[model samples]
Target: MMAFFEKLERKFGRYAIRNLMMYLTALYAVGFVISLVNIQIYYEYMSLDVAKILSGQVWRLITWIMYVPEQNVLFAAIMLVLYYSLGTNLERVWGSFRFNVYMFMGYIFLIIGAFILYAVYGEAASVFLLTPDSLNMSIFLAFALTYPDMTFYLYFVLPIKAKYLAFVYLLIEVYSFIIGGVITKVSIGLSLLNFVIFYLMTRNWNRISPKNVVRQVKFKKAVKMRPAGEPIHRCAVCGRTEKDDDTLEFRYCSKCKGNLEYCSDHLYTHTHVE
Candidate 1:
């Protein structure tokens, strides 16, 4: 377990956002503007009218981000700000390009999942799961798990880690699913499913996301093979070769056989071949 964490830190240490998370915050700002206009057409549009998406009115998929539960501007603004703050951190760490890719994939997955549900269970499941109010909490849950240790001032009184709170949220959702019946369970199921899909795609498993690390290792190997103008043997203690222009001569260490090299200063002391 310790070795596993060490390797992960080495690879993904730079992925923690520095300032790019701000752009995610700004996306929420735009979300706020759309919310103010109260233009919630896509709730019905995406379900029954995806032809609009194919017809080049492509904003339906993206516009759904702006949908809010109530028409309360204050609540919308507050939630947007919070979403932005956490999301931008992820964006900065992952790069805007990768961040957009991840979010877009999540959206696409949700839409596809909705379409399947509609075909199987009809439009009711689509309306229940595809709406902005329904899906936003799933995005929040994703952000919470990514930064599990982050502290938030809950209701401006209780200081709690976001992940712990998110876990509690999940528990309630689970309880609702069990007691609240099929419609409610399906709602929670889709949200959890979306997160699982995204995590598995981005995870370090060799079968899932192998291309990124493979390219890096290939690049390092190419760097190691270049000669430094010296046809020389390698040192065993520290990996270096004697440069051709250097005054000290180097030869394979007799004591170490074909395994080591030594210069003149240590030639006698080190024991080497002529």
Candidate 2:
């Protein structure tokens, strides 16, 4: 899966959008303004209605993303800011191309799920699949997975880890799916499929295992127990020993006159010794 993404990056990375989340947040803000003026207009034109979409109102396919989660104006503002932060961080961690793919795949899944629901129940599917709540939830889930230890203030009072919040959200979604109508159940499942597939593809089992933790501890102990002595190598130009900076890499200057050792920083820039 990583190989496939690498191939995609090589071929199409140049076209990937930078700060894609900022644009999405802008759309939500626009939707909010429209809603304040006349929510009926937004529902009639912007919301994802399969019947309308099938009957030549095809714009809903893309415009449906503007369906911001229902909340008060103050809360909505805070949530959008949080979402923008999450999106930018994910893009940085996963790279622009991969982040684009993750978001686009979620949109594609929602579209397919909408059509599938439409097939199952002719027009009623439109009523239940109105909002992009599932997509928003998936984004939160992704952020939690990526930065499990990050803390956030819940209601500007209590501090809670993002992973714990995500877990609570997951439980709520599970309950909703069990009790919700067919369209609701299907929407939840399809929206989460992107995160599920992504997690499976990118997770490293070894990093999370007990054996790896033990091995790391033993390695650290061995390093600490080593005899104290002068570093075997030192930079000729900088005169900084490896003991001072473990990250410093020493290399013999190939172009220099004798065997002159130079640190990585000065390896190419230093003049040749006579």
Candidate 3:
């Protein structure tokens, strides 16, 4: 899937929107204002009603995303700012093209999932209005997966890691899917399915390949055969091992494609292994 995305990038990269988050944030601002003034207008015209869609109100398919997820202005403001940052950072790391693909795929999934519900429940599905709530969650989940160690403030107070927060969210979503109605199950499943595919595509599958298996055997043998006093952890650059200084800390670079460790002194200074 990653390779397929790369192929698409090569072909359509020119059309990718730069500063895409800026546009999304602008729409969020519009939504926030609407929520402040008249939210009922959104439910009547903009909300995603599968029944209306099937009845030829197809514009609802896209306009529904324009409604702010939170009704409170303060909460809505926070959501807008939080997602804008997440979107921009993701675009920076993944490139404009891949970021666009990730976001648009999420939207596509929601649209398809809504239709699936309509098919299963018929006219009853109209009450299950899909919002951009799950889509925003996807953005946050993607950010967490890409930069798991990144820290966020909880209500501008306590500090928490992105991975931990995503875990809590996943648990909640799973519970909701298990206990809630058919619409909730379908919605949560589709959103989570998007994240699962993104996660799989981002992973280094070669680690489980036959060549890596052979290399692992060789690496283990080398580890055992080395001098007893030799340190197991060493920086890829500068060749300094833990044996050199007890205070020197080492960690694997997350941005690097493979397991490349670096000592604290060189961790941020050295070029990435790619």
Candidate 4:
């Protein structure tokens, strides 16, 4: 799956939207304003009502994302900021295309779940209850997976690790699934399917291991011990240094003049210097 994502990035990464989180944040802001003006109006028109959708209100499919989770103004503000931080950091870690794929796959899973509920229960289904909570949970789960040791102040008081918080939330979700209505069960299962799939695919547990952490710390110290003003080997074309982008290999180009180096990206395609 990661190899498939790599292939996708090579082919389609250029077209991905940068800072996509900002747009998603903006939508939440819009939803907040809409809620202030007339909450019922937006919920009636925009909530993920499959019955209404089948009745030709197709816009609900996309517009339902604008439904912001209810919270006090201060809490909402804090939550939005936290979500923005999580989302942008994930984007930086995963790159634009892969992050986009992760988010959109979550959305697709939710949609499919809703449709399945509608088919099973007909008009009795209330899958629209899922919405923004499940979506937001997925984002949080991804952040916890990526930065497990990162600390947050619980209620601006006690410091707690993100992984612990995520575990608590996961437990709550499992409990909800066991006791909740059919809609809730479906929502929890289908909405978090993205996180489950992503965790399985990336398998980044080794990155958070104590051994890996010590190894990385030692490597950084070694790099820092190097003499000041020493030139680090970097790709002449892309300007990526091994220190910054360890995934890339830099090689001196014998075919090029003036001690030119190139990374794997430009090693072969770059014009040879005379």
Candidate 5:
């Protein structure tokens, strides 16, 4: 796994467009500021209309991530903080490039699914066409799902896992599916699909092949290294240098030794009783 990741890091590098999660957070903040001045501007620019994404307005798929309704200032702020914290951690772990790829891939998949839905039901069938609320919430739901175990203080008092919170949010969306608006239902479905696609594509299971291959190569290289002329110091037990030198072939036993073979350091370290 380490080798595979190292190879990938070498190919992709630490700094790339993907590692710009911080930039995304900043852009989202700026979008909120501008949209607060005029909410309809967000709708016109950021929200991905079925027609727009399909008509090669590719930015629509990604720009929607920055779209937060002007009226929901507090809600958007809370969501952005959570996303920034988790996204930064994820970027550090995966490095910037991989995390960016992970997120953008999710966005791409969601857009593709939306396109398919449009093909089946026609452009107006999209809930996003009717309202942008569903689109905004999908981005939030995707981040929450990615780092579900992340804990946050509920009401600044109770600690709760984001996953549990996500579950509740999902349930709410389910209720919305039954009684909530059409756009709400579409958002819920797309958000869930986003999580599934990301989970599958970046999964550890798919990594096993590259990981094992790199390990095998490393093991082979290690086995091939010869144990060559390693320098040895005195072996105190017998008072002889284990290291071979060119000029001397000193033997240590009483029968062969003319001069006492003990190095000065070994003389005090051990006793040879006659």
Candidate 6:
């Protein structure tokens, strides 16, 4: 999967927005203001309402991303700022392309999860799990897991290791899923799935870093160059070289003289040239 992800990064990396979280944070601010004016306005039009989407209100698909988890204006401001910091740090560590993929993966999953919720409950699953809060929390979780020992000042006073807080959050989500209603269960499930995928991606952050990828490419080229000198094995019967097809296995024939060899395809059938 990392190899496939790298192929995508090479093809599409340049198009990724640098400091993408800044833009997202700005959008979150906009959402916060809009909510202050009228919280119901977003739900009425911008929510990912499948019924509305099928009815041609397709803009909801993209617009629903603006929803922030915080209802209080002050809390929203603080949360946005916190996420902006964590997001920029992640981008610095993983590079913009990787960070972009991480964030967009969450969005895509949220959209898909919204559809699943709709299918399960139709209109009854009104509790939305598509808020930017869940996405940001996923980012924080990734960051914490990546830098487990890193310290965070909880409530701007108590200092604690990020891993501990992440553990607590994980427990809370698990408990919520176990005890919450249908809507809460679905919401938490979506959020956990998004984080799980991202956690897999960032398990070995160094492997995906730009520097590491460049090193791997250089090493691959050097190794390939060494193998270009001459063929190590060749078929005595069909004269097929190892260069022709790597999957073909070659072995020396005991019946043949002068160290003759044959590829797997012709090995058993070839006559001995003694």
Candidate 6 per-residue C-alpha lDDT over 1-274 given as tens digits, one digit per residue, 9 for 90 to 100 = 5556766877998999999999988888888788888889899988877778878999988888888666886788788888899888778767788788888887887778788877887766566435655566778788786567678999899999889999998898788889987656666677778778766753545456676667657655755776556776778878888689765566555446565667755653466685
Q: Could you estimate the TM-score for every candidate?
A: 0.54, 0.75, 0.76, 0.73, 0.56, 0.70
105 in model 3: Cα distance from truth in Å? 0.9
Clashes of each: 5, 0, 0, 0, 1, 0
lDDT of 5 by residue, 1-274 (tens): 4346546656876456754767877878987887878877766766767776667777876677666554487877887786677677656544566566566655665566666668777866545453334444544465565456557789889998777877877787778888866455565566667666655654545225675556547645754673566433334355355454332223222312222333322322234445
Name the regions of candidate 6 deviating beyond 4 angstroms: 123-129, 202-274
Give one digit per residue, the lDDT tens place, for model 4 in 72-166: 68877887899999999888766787678788888888888888888888887754445867778889888887667778899899999889999
**Model-by-model lDDT, in order?**
0.56, 0.77, 0.79, 0.77, 0.59, 0.75
Which 10 residues in a row give candidate 4 its minimum summed lDDT?
A: 246-255
User: What lDDT, from 0 to 1, does candidate 5 have?
Assistant: 0.59
Candidate 3 pairs with clashing backbones: none
Q: Model 6: clashing residue pairs? A: none
Worst 10 residues of 3 by lDDT: 247-256
Question: Model 6 reaches what TM-score against the true structure?
Answer: 0.70
Candidate 3: clashing residue pairs, number: 0
Best by lDDT: 3
Off by over 4 Å in 2: 204-274
Model 1 lDDT per residue over 36-88, tens place: 66445435443223444555757666665544555577776688777666666
Global Cα RMSD, each model: 16.1, 9.4, 5.8, 7.8, 18.5, 15.8
**Clash pairs detected, candidate 5:** 19-96
Instruction: Report the Cα lDDT for residue 81, model 1.
Output: 74
Cα shift from native, residue 200, model 3 (Å): 2.1
